[model samples]
Target: MARIGITGHSNLTAASAPLVREALVTQLSLHHDRLIGVTCLARGADQIFARAVLDVGGSFEVVLPAADYRDRKVKPDNAAAFDELIGKASQVRTMPFEESNRDAYMAASEHVLSSVDAMLAVWDGRPSGGRGGTGDVVQAARERGIPVTVVWPEGAERE
Candidate 1:
């Protein structure tokens, strides 16, 4: 199976969600039947990608930054969607941490990059805001010689 990992903006605007989802589904369709998506399943891009993967008849592997990542990082509004996606994931991996932190996030990011055959980044072409941001993961993927596909449709903005 072909494993494709996802990393992208956590604060994507609502207006861009559908656009991103459609583009992602279209891209993943090229892989046909042998597709497995790996993602951290955070809000925004992660959730969007998971939906696209499932829509394309692909399984998903969720990587949590910490054991209590959802409790610590997921907001009440996004909890339902997050929970639904988690329930649909074929596998769930949690980092060796009690709570969400920079180290845990980086570890999770590295795990995704190392486990996938390729990576899909839904970025706005900006530099990463911090260590475990999309830009950092995309750079790491490229340096490791993994193919990286960047998806940022015109007019897609962050929330």
Candidate 2:
């Protein structure tokens, strides 16, 4: 079994990745019994991936970047459901980084990557804001030799 991680745009107004993630969940289940761990950032791709992982029988893990979930602010109506999912995760890891530094991103990302066998990138096909862009993360996944599947919305550029 091989774990699969996901990367994509955060703070999005349009959503096509959710459907893609649900499909991936089905694909993963049909192909492998691998554990599914996702960063519970509650942004673009994180929420959908976590839900899909939960939908299947695969183990779910949340690699948070802090000791408290307070830093994770969620506006979803199913806030309770989100909390419930994280609580049910097989493992929960946090780095407890106060400053937004490169080391923090690397440590958190490394933790996420360590448990994964492949990556599913749901990008907008554009330059994401900040250093923690999904594109950069996908590149890192490639560097780590993980197979990647990039899913973009309709009309979004493809490579």
Candidate 3:
């Protein structure tokens, strides 16, 4: 079985979404029936990864940053998808923070890194814009000697 984690940008352009999703599906398919995806279940890359994992017959686990993440961080536009993905997760873990913040997000990403064999980063090769952004997660995974695959398809662009 292959257990993979995901970290990615939340502001991918609409035209790039399909390209990223296709790439994720292709990568997840390699693990086939024994695939297990680990993610924070955030809006962009995480949600896309979760869907791809399920599409490839894999079960995914969620690592929530904080107790109030769903209410505070998950915007209304993305709430339905988040709820559906949460419902489909094989396991859901929340960090010990009452509020969602950068520290909590980093901690949750660390938690995901600790259990996964590999990490998939849907990034654009840019530096992180904030404390717990995609670059930080990818860097943390690399520092921990976890294999990371950057899945920025040819035409993938950030918003």
lDDT of each: 0.93, 0.66, 0.94
Residue 114 miss distance in model 2 (angstroms): 2.4
- Model 2 gets an lDDT of 0.66
Q: Write the per-residue lDDT of candidate 3 for residues 1-159, one digit (tens) a residue.
A: 999999999999889888999999998877755999999999889999999998888999999999999999999999999999999999999999999999999999999999999999999999999999999999999999999999999989887
Q: What are the clashing pairs of model 3?
A: none
Candidate 1: worst 10 consecutive residues by lDDT? 25-34
Residue 75 in model 3: shift from native, Å? 0.7
Error of 2 at 84 (Å): 2.2
Better by TM-score, candidate 3 or 2: 3
Q: How big is the RMSD of model 3? A: 0.8
Candidate 3 C-alpha error for residue 90, in Å: 0.7
Model 2 C-alpha lDDT per residue in residues 14-71, reported as the tens digit of each score: 4455556655576557545556666745555777677777677676777766554434
**Candidate 3: which stretches are off by over 4 Å?**
none
Q: What is the lDDT of candidate 3?
A: 0.94
Q: Candidates 1 and 2: which is better by lDDT?
A: 1
